[model samples]
Target chain A: MSNNEHVKVPANLMRRFADDPEQADLEVFGRRSDGDRRGFLRGAGLATMGAMLGAAIPFNRNMPAGFVPEALAQKAMTVDGKDGLTVLNDRPVNAETPPHLLDDDVTPTARHFIRNNGIPPENTSADGWSLTVDGLVNNPMTLSIADLKSKFEVVTERLVVECGGNGRAFFDPPAKGNQWSLGAVACSEWTGVRYSDVLKAAGVKDNVIYTAHVGADSHLSGKDGKLAISRGVPIEKAMNPHNLIAFAMNGKELHPMNGAPLRLVVPGWPGSCSQKWLKRVWLRDVVHDGPKMTGKAYRVPKYPVEAGQKVPKGDFEIIQAMPVKSLITTPQTGIKMSGRSMKVGGHAWAGDGKVSKVDVSIDFGATWQSADLSDPANPYAWQRFGAGITFPMAGYYEVWARATDSEGRSQPFGIAWNPKGYLNNSMHRISVYVS
Target chain B: MMQRLLPHLFVLVLLGAILLAPGRPAWADEDELGGIPRAPGAEETYYLCSACHSFRLVAQQGLSYESWKETLVWMIEEQDMSTPEPEERELITKYLAKFYGRDRLARKLAKQQ
Candidate 1:
């Protein structure tokens, strides 16, 4: 039969069958005309059909005559293991929390954004998982979860982990990676032993200058032994007491998408530095040349480049502490209010410094008023800020948030253009209509 | 012109289906080319690029032809992608630049503003 002659199956029904064949109504397949079904089966056998679907049909025998499987149903764009996230890409599974859903001070694990560069490792259970600390170490060691717990002092702290490419969607030329908006960040409570403790236990050599982190996630190309991503930080950053080899989030075992059983939580820097599904920590004498470390994977232009400027490879530098940024979590955009007065609140953080202030403006940056900023629960935790703003009159207004770091650096009015579109900490604005 | 390319595109799609058959169940619907409008090289572009990452990643960008060519070169050199024939490379670049070209940048900026 010609391709056009094949009966079209609805994508949702195909997804239902793929997700749970047992729950599927086999009679639906039987409803098709016998002649067409026979022709389809004869033209492309059950094996070929299954191959086209990318898996063997578990209940192929039960599939009655005249059944035609549609093109492999695209996995439903909605994420299976997340809550209320806007999926950008489903293949390597990158989703972001909408600003409305990110209202909680301590972000719920389910609401946290999922950013995966590679397919998550299948065997995420703690039973057989082990972490090896080697390279430039006087005493290389491998430790299990139990051993890690018994040997080191376990600590829990609320820390913010933001993607390096957060707000990339605002880039004018459009970045090459996931077009993350404002929600690729979350401040969650993580429990684990400090990374410094682990490295010290391994007896770091004096010559070690950088750390290379490896994870179990497989590369997208299905290449054997090829890592999905391997990024690291400088030795000084790795040894920061606030950094942790986190195994738990929000008082529970880490979610598989967030790196179950074991992961790194190097807060304040790019989230890529905190490798998920962590397998090894290798100390290196020189900069770690991992899959994403070299070239322009997570780096930005050393100096600011114009929107369409061509940047040479040597001019790019790795992003360290994220620039000062803030997000308005409550009173989501497009909200309509009857009164002139409104309460606005959100969270703010600086990469290596504390958020000194977060100012709110309703007149499109014409004037600014300081919001009451709260102290962080712990180092690296985001500070909550809120303010009561009284509008002059009923009209459409935009609330813009600009956060300043302890060093007095503040968010810019526009995105600082770069080739890779990393580190876009422009001031965030939301729309509100008042009558 | 499209009619001539259809047969070759079908063969490539069939090969992709067969090559991808033995692995894990398809996580993504292979037939659903997100945001990639039908064009001369749509099938070939979908089959080749979707072999690794989502076509949505490609659809998100709006770059000049030179930038798109540089991306393809980067893929071959750094991303372990096999280099395509010169003609095939040109075809893919032309298709990408035509659909996801500099105009997309203007549309995105307007939408955001």
Candidate 2:
């Protein structure tokens, strides 16, 4: 660990979805950085960190504008500022979380799962926002939020995010926009600045390939902001190593409907390009895809339909990574699960692949078993699982699980209905209780 | 929030056209279209259903007069909601009485019509 060392990714990971806060650009992707510091990609493996030389905009170096920093200015109008329960700001970015779950490792930030395309800023701040970075780098900075936590080196992960319209409004012809259930998806613990430590502090310039991200929310299209809210990743998920730029989520800070200060967790991928209030990343050169990537919307119809069908407008492709899933956290849907030995739990993931096996079922997919799971120390996280089953006779039973992964995919019986209801992975059901 | 998600998206496009057009009384209307406000309740159903389309989709509906006419024909062919004009579905079923008149014959004809 010599030649100016650097590895530190530390502290506050995720505990039952974590303590919540840090959004609205999580202080513009940063804040709270002290001394021994050193995080610019933990010793510049992507080649001597210093992103093109911070791309050069330290507060208008000859006027480049849009940077925001006066203590993130304003936005906090309600996620609980008052009579909250506006079902997390009343429907659309996927008509608020409803995709089979009795519990999946804490998603209750008011059913945690939104999906936003435009309208989310509410009240507002991070002062006005700006990040820039630019193509093939070479020090192209724009910083602010106190120059990205006083110039950089801060990373945290826990991850989860998910909203290629989280279940895309259960697709079909229905695939026009945000009716998202399964709560658009959420998991927390973001903390920022390691988009390869801002692409090695900004110095990559060579033939590029692809890397966009954008987002400030309003280009306002409506049909729930009509798709293409900006996306393009593929500079190896944009310089990978676990793409962060996050700012904060379960450590208290992110709140503009969860994309404040800055966002782009990337972990398992699919939350509308994971952009959210995030400002810019740029770097394209030749493989862009920009109508929010690949043009117009998160396409799908290369084939497979029959649950609802309306996927027609040019057929699909943009949406990605979201498959083997699970839910059932408590019994609040009209309530009734506290009787049959019934324990059941939730949270599973797979698209980028790895889950392995989940199973469950009680009736609506017929008999199966497996359950117990909980693994995830982070293989992209989200595992939990559980089981108990015991009502044998009493009454209501439905319960379900499914999972499978390691790339065999499983959890199907339902994702093909593509109006916009993207990648379902089915088998969730939920019904319990029996005295 | 975008007007509380436009009435659960006109109740999921009137629950996907009552699961793809099955019956058809979908709130029958040879345009006898009674007084219009159909059943309104609070603040005159948010001051007459946001003058049409933003009582956040008439306060996120709970419709089923056959998915409220395919959710009012997907809000009059994609949210324009015209046609039964003259009293405008009797002022949106009398401002959909306390939330889409939860039928009991729309709360006894929303108080004797």
Candidate 3:
């Protein structure tokens, strides 16, 4: 896993589908023949190819230029890694931790999914890091990591930080951006100061409508280095007791990739609201129209749009609480079952409130069996569930998990497609083969 | 390592296909600029789109001609991406539609699903 090690790309990108990575004929793929490739390449000139290759000539991060980080690369090479997660992009590195890898009560930092809008800051040292609280406040203040630890109560809570577009790949037409499967979600124990306590210290004004969270990471657009992804939530959500200005994860300092030094942990909302490498929290009068807040970045249809229907500009609604979602982690997709029965378990969470119940459908939603839902450690922590099922025959089967929130909201069978492909909390399905 | 080599190898395989079998382009946009497949105006499209992020990000999405045009307008007004010349826009738009169009995207999605 060292930088100097020679990394070999596995010929196969899929896990359960292709059991033999070594024998996967990546060149021919499954259906595309040699002639099809030749015609496509003939249309695509080598001059262009040569030019792109030239840009990558000086791969000097002490590693390959276009390659993923050493850790991610190593993880993807192993059989377990292939089944555990998929890397969507490498530069601003985006990767999803397979639902099976996230079966644990607390998601390990290494297994946490990464969703970065900008390049991570190189200076991760906490020695000089400070967080400034300004805008719509009576008294603005700046606090360091040590000050945050000593000044305010530090509490630990297990919660899920899910991307808004977690299950986008399953969209019929397929949405834009990372065609993420069911891996863009994970739960972790975060230790930090209560954001409400910080807001009290800052002496927020009554007129404040929103609180903007800013980070130090620079935009990858190459336009301006100072351009960072600064987004915010409503004042009510910002002042919630559960939100945190986290400095540590699982009793350790935050990983650089996970926004080291400090980050906003706004549970139940889109992960983008929890800005990593957090530098500022600016209270605003109107909705904070920062980088991602404008346009249709995080907004979906106000009302459901039929699949493939175009949404008008004003018909969009900003995403707030995520929908009810659950994933079956144990027995993973593609598990070869030697016995007729197997134990299945996973986690579920509701954005607006706590999970009320979870149902497992082994017969592809024909019938459902209620899984025992565990009491949450905290209000926002994901609730764990387990169920045992016996197969009638040896064949292929899909285990679908559906979660319902306290508000009686259950996950939809299929997601309504939007341009940005946000908030896809459809029933999670895992395919298994019984021998 | 293998993660990095995987995309390069896939692109190379697609490149290799140029000889006997010229099939549909494989999913090639998941890395930095280097991973973009070669096509008409491929260089122009990659450089222009990549000024903001990797071409792979752009290549991942499937947008219609009108939606792509709207995306350009939004980029200019919101994301600070520069607008290309009229002629340049036509080329880039055509290139985008050809490589990352709805048809191409359907193939990629169908294969993965």
Candidate 4:
């Protein structure tokens, strides 16, 4: 912001990256114009939440700075691994059930949530790095690590990225996609070069409405040896200033799992649009539809389906912004509360839209009251909401939260179950206790 | 946007198809409770087991036999591979080399169609 506080990296800059026939020079993040090379990254806003309290985050051991400890801010606690109540993945514990519900305005990186496609990538660095900007462009170029830094103007924004499969495990009937438990989402202050800069460099053409992006890590390949990553966004969404080509988080370098060197930051969208380990950006007018693109994943039934019905391919559309929803962080379901004033907090988010109002219900939707919403500062950022309720009487309080967006879109209570547990906007609920 | 995708919905065929896969190419054998092990030894176990590492889209991989073999070696060195019995290893090798082997596409497709 200049002395006038004018919007610097204005929101519409993303439009410049669209399929414009006139291509501009693309710049990567981290270059200081005066011969210093920077990489793509989001700066300011929320501090980067890398690192954790108890365990070590391998692969991304060496990180740059500006990463606030919100991601890593947590009272360290490691459970006894012998307990069968654990799901083992990357490390002994990829995720855990917090002893108490969380109410912190910011989700600590350690307690954020754990969802992995495969083991997190290690040993990735800014050196030997290059971002490939191609497809539907006049100039397709492979930008060297330094090329991205030295050339582009850098800006920062804070937004939340939630996996489409978030909250999938709670679905009534199991679905095909990863049945991710609640913690698959995280918010970050992404700092990076503008997608517009890169798009300008690549020189977008007319008649393009969408762009497809692929990641670096390829697991078991599909037929023809296609890599395992997949994702895309409408030209409109990508052009939103909130949409970022992030190179840094919380002021430091990126971890491999989070897409070091570069990643997309599509505000109000699911993790799908923010492809990690980002390698290539294809600026095509055609919609993406490989197995990773349009096939078999990140889709929801286009309309409501009967409960317990299996989702067929045709009944759904790609999941974009999350529904108006909130999570009760404290007194997590099954928590015991004393006969006193208890502070309750959780997170509320609306996809591509602003979270306008949040209401909390203690008695399983019997009644509702407004909850305090956090000033995310940025429209695309997650709002930390809270409420204080006295448990005068308590047996089992089915606590839940509902949110409404600036567009007047509120979360529905228990959306119909689909085959692949896609966007579940059901009112966020957690059961608690009063002794 | 109320777009009628019923024309594009593959439910009619797929709903009927999912239930009838018992006799298909990927059918599980009932006689052997453990069925036939796909690969044998530490290296083979990684190939057979890690192929379906996790159900996550990022985790699902349909690896070829050759790559699977290479992956097993890497896993053993990078990721720890537990050792197994010799005879069990032989059974796994026979089954995997025959079923998941590079040339098994012909037999698998014939069974499916």
Instruction: Show model 3 residue runs off by greater than 4 Å.
Output: A1-84, B1-35, B105-113
For candidate 4, what is the lDDT?
0.55
Evaluation by lDDT, superior candidate among 2 and 4: 4
Q: Per-residue lDDT tens digits of candidate 1, residues A1-435? A: 213222222223443344334223221221221243332232234334543354445455455553445444433356555788877776777888988788888999988898999889988999989999999999999999988999999999999999999888787777777888889999999999999999999999999999999999998888899887999999999999999999999999999989998999999999999999998999999999999999888998888788978899898888899999999988988899999999999999999889999999999999999999999999899999999999999999999999999999999998898988789999989999999
lDDT of 2 by residue, B1-113 (tens): 96999977866664443334322222222012211223233333344333432333333233434434445555455433345664565454444532343342322321111
Question: How does chain B score by TM in each prediction?
Answer: 0.64, 0.22, 0.61, 0.34
TM-score of chain A, every prediction, order shown = 0.84, 0.30, 0.84, 0.74
Residue-wise lDDT of candidate 4 within A65-98, one digit each (tens)? 2221222212222333212121324221244334
Steric clash pairs (candidate 1): A37-A66, A73-B29, A74-B29
Sort by lDDT, best first: what order? Answer: 1, 3, 4, 2
Which sections of candidate 4 miss by over 4 Å?
A: A1-108, A111-114, A118-123, A221-225, A310-312, B1-49, B52-113
DockQ of 2: 0.01
Give lDDT tens digits, candidate 2, residues A1-435.
122112111111111012222221121122111133222111111111111111211222221112222222221122442122223223223234454432545444454555554556564477656778877788888776557766777766666667655544333333333334455665656677777777777876777877887766653323444333678667766666766777666665676666777777776767666777777778868767655565335656777757544456566665556666766554443346445575667778775667877878777776788888877756566787787877677666677778888867687765567644566656657566465
Chain A of candidate 2 compared with the true chain A, TM-score: 0.30
Where does candidate 4 chain B have its weakest 10-residue lDDT segment? B25-34
lDDT of 3 by residue, A114-151 (tens): 88888788998899999999998999999999999999
Residues B4-68 of candidate 4: C-alpha lDDT, one tens digit per residue? 66634544444333333222211122111112222334244434554535211212222344444
The lowest-lDDT stretch of 10 consecutive residues in candidate 1 chain B is: B22-31
